[model samples]
Target: MLEVRCLLRSVRFCSSAPFPRHKPSAKLSVRDALGAQNTSGERIKVQGWIRSVRSQKEVLFLHVNDGSSLESLQIVADSSLDSRELTFGSSVEIQGQLVKSPSKRQNVELKAEKIKIIGNCDAKAFPIKYKERHPLEYLRQYPHFRCRTNVLGSILRIRSEATAAIHSFFKDSGFVHIHTPIITSNDSEGAGELFQLEPSGKLKVPEENFFNVPAFLTVSGQLHLEVMSGAFTQVFTFGPTFRAENSQSRRHLAEFYMVEAEISFVNSLQDLMQVIEELFKATAMMVLSNCPEDVELCHKFIAPGQKVISFVDKAQYICCLIISYTEAVEILKQASQNFTFTPEWGVNLQTEHEKYLVKHCGNIPVFIINYPLAIKPFYMRDNEDGPQHTVAAVDLLVPGVGELFGGGLREERYHFLEERLARSGLTEVYQWYLDLRRFGSVPHGGFGMGFERYLQCILGVDNIKDVIPFPRFPHSCLL
Candidate 1:
């Protein structure tokens, strides 16, 4: 039997028999056609599910989607194949000659020499059909098959690209990437929401689990990354994080991914803000260059009328205008969107505000920093001129997602850390975190960006639930 195994990023070669490699038939894609002039007259083998099938009396046109790029491969399958089985979502492989000019909207079309059905999907029950629009809720329920859709496939692809770019940007900057533990006894920064675990088969009591101590899914990797930064000078951790909040908004998910980076011996908040701006700009440029197909999909579905070419051009222009936080706010206020409220300094930004800024202003990308500490996390370093207890924290809000990142310089001084803890009324549960300060500490800073939220920003996806493969939102946790 021919076998196939799928990995998260790369599909693996799965077969019992030795496979023939005659130039390893080039895997032509729907996206390949966009650059088809390069693949002219090449014999290619394309593998994907049929996204949409149009069968007339003379020719059968199958829109094959491999989730490689946002577009679909136009395959001209002859009437020799049974029309009944050649319906939507059927996995198929087409061996054909690539044609550069297809006389259609698509730039490339496959003149199929042969067609073979790898896995047949029933058209009647195919969740994605040719007729009506499906609700987002219904699609979420069928996540296993959601990627077959053009929009979801585009989102996943863009997410993968953005993640790669993140590593590339930081690694190129000489920052070491670290992996933080998922289950640990210590609550790093003493944040309230944690999902505790029980290790010994079952729990007679919460304390009787592993190590006779309670462990929970980590909420943020900032604490451990901070420790690593003390030793390595610069480090980052990109991984999954969980929050047990029960809020059912589209933005909140119980389990999500986070990208965290920490640096040591930073001069002041200005240095932090500078790093933040550079990182966001690099990310935007990276996405624009690497995932133009996915970016087009984002504009098509998430924000209609948003052209990828225009967005990149505008972003570059607006990024120039955003020298200060006040300037960013003013640009956001003047944006052409139906904003429910106005954008101003000291006011916590909403999703609408961020969308306006990214879609309007200079349009490349901007980093709004120096938020009022009252609205930020407790671990941020207190600002010199701010009111009592406010810290030098920053949240990086992007175009589509309001607060894509949350982080700040940690309270390095033991006395100040303890005082802040007591003042916030969270002293009792964080004695161990306090002990880290007592033993040996350094002036360290970092921030956490929700991995899925970052994906949403890049792909122009609206719902947090869509980016994650299996979502764990309030009132729903199903595979």
Candidate 2:
């Protein structure tokens, strides 16, 4: 009788269990709604900050943006639903129905049925004033709030697209993606511009140091990519590189991203040059095709009143011209204009010299190859020219931005590399680097392109700081 009573109680408890509730679907992004067709009469939810608001006696019109696209969605709300807090920079959520718009700027509009304020923002205290065009330099002072501006929003979108295009270019070419270390013992450039790592709040002895001897933030990932090239025929790395230089120029940054690639079994410098040309052209074409509106916005910001051209259009007229370093020197000598730094055989090319060379070639991209050996690093291959003394190094100089890309064939001969390293006082530290050539080294080459510099070139942005999200320089590291 007791067992029968317990069974009845269990059956009653099972019958009283609650059923599972289904979750609501996710909200549609502004970009999705802009591209969608036949969304009329459909109820949708959108959450974003107010870019602009107009309150009228009969109705209220709000321009809302969610950073998904360059254009904003027009929302029409009843006058009764409008509140004083629905000003610029205020965050809110709206439930509305999509309908055909009578305005010419957009094809569709949202008729708000419910409006809820998530966060209220005071218009008088906001740093970004409405309807005011702020200079890029002024915007630099407010990095935290500058992204809400239209100019920065467009630049960031283009930057993101360019990054994706780079990855696609490498993946389609059968290249493997590699991640090199940020903390390394050797400076790849051998320029002695490394940021050394030390313990916090105390001076530790050499034996008690973090890396025991000395570790530094890597100036370049070229050396690590070279190590990976031994196993993978083609490999690349894209990440932040650091430098301790004290330059406060628009071109210099304390930390920046570098896109480096290494290829094995290359025959000559021309093969590597071909890779560089195709990579630039392919990436440019992708960005121009994918983000036309964003690119246009950037051009408008940089060069107002100038007609903006499609990347494909500009690329069609531009051809990659290759000139020997000797020929380039001769050309500079014959130029009618005076240069700040005279174009000598052994001296590295300055920014003015590079821009002049591009202009001399009818404002096109030019690859200046076979630079003097003394001006380059120890890893560059030595050209067999007797008196000229040049190495198989190259720099791709575009019209606006000088020296956009630099690369060369690496020294693969074991004895030659060892001798070069010994002269540079890095033989002991890079004995492992020498081992690659000692065991089995094939002909290889690669190049490094500054990521921010590339965006500045493509988008016509004058300053490198404007292209990057966060600008880092000497005495100026702000949020």
Candidate 3:
């Protein structure tokens, strides 16, 4: 039987037909074609998904978008070149003459010689229709098809450009980028809102846990970035973070991206806040300047008359825009607007308080520092001020978005960390963290900025879900 099988395989290999061969043609993206005025009258192949198809008796016009930009290229084809498959949302390829458009709406257009439909869309079954201004909530249901919309396409481009700008900022500032672990043994925030990680098919009992320890999706990468900051002096990480938060609010998400940076030899909260301000300002400016068209599309539709954040040199250079958390509480207490959660020194600040505080600061980014130590994590450095104990922490509150960033100087003293951990019974679990303090520990601090909030602040987007490509919330993890 083995010999017969071998003979059959050999015969099949010899009798198999060769695959078809085709020459690859040079392609032109809509963005490049629009920019290239010198390429007029040249023959080129353009490929993209059909945005709008208008049929006439003599001329067939189609607006195609390749997601390279917000603008779509106009393809002017003969009426005879039209096909049933060339409908909205369908993909197509065309060999055409690039010429000046007769209509002033566009500078140049594609005068097509050959038209081919690469993929067809079922218009009736499609969840989205062309040229319809669909609400963001309605678009949320169809995650797979949402990017095909103009709003989402522009958002994704802005997101991509912002990501690149972040990397570029860190690179130019001599900061090392670290890819922190997605799965960690310790809950960095200690919030108890962790997504416990386990293998897919098997439910291991307490006696036999995977890797012989409890692990979870990390809520923050600050601790891991701290480990690297020890040697590098400056390190940054930008990636997805998970929190098992059950709230269905517009701002909350189960999975979101965080931009975290740890700087070594930082003694005070002021030093850490400077880096945070610069990082946000530089990246936001880059996104605005590079993707102007995309930004305009989002701002015009989602947030009308919204202006991008403009930070001045002297404003950021000076730290006068900061207020102590105690002062913030006092201001909130004096506010006429009744806050759901009353302003108190020991309690955490809510969104209403944050909004009031930002408004009090002339709608500028306000840095609220020295939060109550009892509410903060064990990692924050203690103020040691009697009666009203506070931590060397800071939270950046913006006008549109409440709390955009939060961070503080770490507890670098050995005795302080030991006692804090002992009080919480985390001494055994975070021994590796303590070990870093034992030898050559320097004063270090870091901060984490919510990437989605940054986008929201810059683009004037209302919901956090609209910024991210695949939003993961309480009960929704659509593909």
Any runs in candidate 3 off by more than 4 Å, and if so which? Answer: 1-25, 202-206, 305-320
lDDT of 1 at 305: 57
lDDT per residue as tens, model 2, 358-408: 889977789999999888999999887899878899999986788989999
> Candidate 1 on 1-479: residue-level lDDT in tens?
13322352234335445777654567756566546675566888888888788888888888887777666778886776687877787888889888765476977788888888999988898777765556566788787777766667767777777788889989998899999999876666555688888655445555356666777889878777766765798899889888888788878899888888898887576676666666666777887888776777667667665444465435544443333455667777666666787776677677777766655654445556555666666577766564533466666656556667666777778887788789887787677667767766777787777888766666566688988878997778877
Candidate 2 yields a Cα-based lDDT of 0.87
TM-score of every candidate relative to the true structure: 0.79, 0.93, 0.92
Backbone atom clashes (below 3 Å) for every candidate = 6, 0, 0
Give the Cα lDDT of each candidate: 0.72, 0.87, 0.88
Residue pairs with colliding backbones in model 1 are 257-451, 314-362, 315-363, 315-364, 318-362, 381-392
lDDT score of model 1?
A: 0.72
Expressed as tens digits, the lDDT of each residue in 263-324 for candidate 3 is: 99999898888888888778877787799888778778998765443432223443438899
Best-to-worst ranking by lDDT: 3, 2, 1
User: Which of the numbered candidates is closest to the native, going by highest lDDT?
Assistant: 3
Error of 3 at 281 (Å): 0.9
